[model samples]
Target chain A: MKLVIAVVQDKDSNRLLNALVEKDFRATKLASTGGFLKAGNTTFLIGVEDAKIPHLLEIIKQNCESRDQLVAPVSPLGGSADSYVPYPVEVQVGGATVFVLPVEQFVQY
Target chain B: MKLVIAVVQDKDSNRLLNALVEKDFRATKLASTGGFLKAGNTTFLIGVEDAKIPHLLEIIKQNCESRDQLVAPVSPLGGSADSYVPYPVEVQVGGATVFVLPVEQFVQY
Candidate 1:
C-alpha cells in the first residue's frame, strides 16, 4: 500500500472529495494550514494499492487546478505620492502539490 | 511552546498567513485532506506563546469566516429521467478548526 499526500487549495476540496468517494476510495482528512502563505489548506492521507496510482492522478487532474493570484511585493517602496510606485506581483497558486512516498506499513484496526 | 493546528479552507490561507506575519507569528504549513468531505484542506502548525491565543483567534475570525456551499446528497435516486431529485444540500464550509495541544517537548537546533 502507498500513502499519497496531496496539498491543494481549499477552494477545490469539495469537488475533489466527491470525486474520490465516487471512485470508492477513502481518505483521512486533517484540517491544516500553510506555513509559507499562512492560508487555509487541507492535508489528505490516502492509502491505496500501488496500481491505483493512475486513478488517484486522474482524480487530482480533474479536480485540483492551479491559478494565479495578485499579491503586493513584500518590500514596497516608501515614498510620498510623487515617488511611490505600487509593486504588484502575480503568483501562481493552486493545483496539487503532492508527495508520494513508500510506506513501510499501514494498518487500520 | 504550543503547537496550534488550524484546519481551514484553502481560500483563506494567504490572507490568514499575511495576518500572522503582520503579527510576527511563524507557522508550519502541511497539505492535508478531510476524511468526511474528501476535499482539499490545509493544516497549519503555529507556535506561539500561550498568551497569544487571543491574537491568533482574532486573525482567524477576520479571515476564516464561514460560508454556505452546495453539495449533492450521497444517496442519489436512480431511474434516469423519471425518479430524480437534484437533492442539493447547502452546507457551511470554512472557518478555523483549531486544535491546541501541549507539546511534551520542542527543540530547534
Candidate 2:
C-alpha cells in the first residue's frame, strides 16, 4: 500500500472529497495554508493499493486545477516599514503538492 | 526546516493546535478517521526548526493522550451472514503517529 499525501486549496477540497467518496477512495482531510499565500488549503491523506495511485492522481487533477489568485504582499522582517504600499499580485494557486510514500506497515488496529 | 506530520485524535486536536499556536508554531490541521475504529482523528502538519522537534513532541505528548475505545468487531468478508454478531472490543486510541521529514526547499513568496 502507498500513502498519498495531497495538498489542495480549500475551494477544491469539497469537490475532491466528494469525488473520492464516489469512487470509494477514503481520505483524511486536513486544514492547511500555503506558506506564500497564507490562504486556507486542505491536505488529504489517502491510503490506497499500489495500482490505484494513477486513478487517485487523475481524480485530484480534475478537481484541483491551478488558478490565479490575488494576494497582498507581506512585508519582510527587519525591512523599513515606511513607504510600504501593499500591492495585490496574482499568483497561481489550487494545484496540489503530492507526496507518495511507501508504507512499511499498515495496521488497522 | 523539518515538516512534522502528526496524526492525533479529534478530541485532542484543539488543545494541541492551541498549544502550538501559543508557542508560535504554525501547523495545518486535517480531518481523518481511524481505519479500525472508524472514529474521527486529526492530522497536523507542522513546519518547525529542527532544534525545536523535541519541544513540539513534548507539546503533542501533553495534549494527545491515548485511551481505550470500544469498537464493534467487523465480520470478515464472505463469512456466514446470519451467524455473525459483532461484540464491542476495547482498543487503544489517541496516541500520535509523527513523521519528521527534511524539507529541501522552504520558500515564502
Every model's DockQ: 0.12, 0.11
For candidate 2, the TM-score of chain A alone relative to the native chain A: 0.73
Model 2 ranges off by over 4 Å: A36-38, A68-93, B1-39, B44-109
In model 1, the runs with Cα more than 4 Å from the true position are A36-38, A68-93, B1-109
Docking class of 1: incorrect
Native-to-model Cα distance after best TM-score fit, residue A104 in candidate 1, in Å: 2.1
lDDT of 1 by residue, B21-65 (tens): 889999877765555232466767788777887777778767876
Query: Which pairs of residues collide in model 2?
Result: A29-B31, A30-B30, A31-B29
Model 1 per-residue lDDT tens digits across residues A19-75:
888898866566667742335777666666799989898898778767678987454
Task: Please report how far candidate 1 places residue A61 from its true position, in Å.
Answer: 2.1
In terms of lDDT, the best-performing candidate is: 2
User: Chain A TM-scores, all candidates?
Assistant: 0.70, 0.73
Tens-digit per-residue lDDT, B1-109, candidate 2: 8877677778778999999999999999766654312467877789989889888888988887577889897986798877776788888767666666667789887
Error of 1 at A3 (Å): 0.4
Q: Give candidate 2's whole-model lDDT.
A: 0.77
DockQ of 2: 0.11
Give the per-residue lDDT digits (tens) of candidate 2, residues A48-88. Answer: 88999999999999998788889898885677878565887
- Minimum summed lDDT over a 10-residue window in model 1 chain A is located at A100-109
